[model samples]
Target: MPATTVLRPRSRTLIIAATVPLALAALLADDVRVRRQLDAVPPDPTSSRTDSTTLVPASS
Candidate 1:
C-alpha cells in the first residue's frame, strides 16, 4: 500500500483560522485612533446628565 497525504481540508482550515484573528485585529486597531479623537471632544454636563429631565429639548 502506498502512503498518501491529504492537503486540501487541512490547508483550508489553516487559512480560515489565520484570517479570523487578522480581521479582528484590523478592526480593533482602528479603535485606538477613534478613542483618541473621542477623547478630544469635551464632555458636556448637560448631555451626560443621568437625569433625562435635565436634557434640553431641541426646538423644532
Candidate 2:
C-alpha cells in the first residue's frame, strides 16, 4: 500500500513567506512604471496660464 503525504503547517508558512515579497515587488514595479509615464508627459501651458482674451469686459 502507498503512503499518502500530508502538507505540514511549516510548509504553508514558507510558501506564504516566499510569495508575499514577490507580490509586493510586482506592485511596486508597476507603480514606478506608471509614475515614469506620467512624469514623461508635458504639462499644458495654455491651461495653466490665464489669458486676457478669456476675460469678459463688464458693461457700465
TM-score quality measure for candidate 1: 0.50
Clash count per candidate: 0, 0
Model 1 residue 8 distance off true place after TM-score fit, in angstroms: 1.6
Q: Per-residue lDDT for 1-60 in model 2, tens only?
A: 345676689998999999999999999999999888876877667675454235566699
Q: Residue by residue across 1-60, what tens digits does model 1's lDDT show? A: 335755589898999999999999988989988878877777678765664335577799
**Local error of candidate 2 at residue 30 (angstroms):** 0.7
* TM-scores of the models, in the order given: 0.50, 0.62
Report how far residue 40 has shifted in candidate 1, in Å: 1.9
Report the C-alpha displacement of residue 52, candidate 2, in angstroms. 23
| Alpha-carbon local distance difference test for all models | 0.78, 0.80
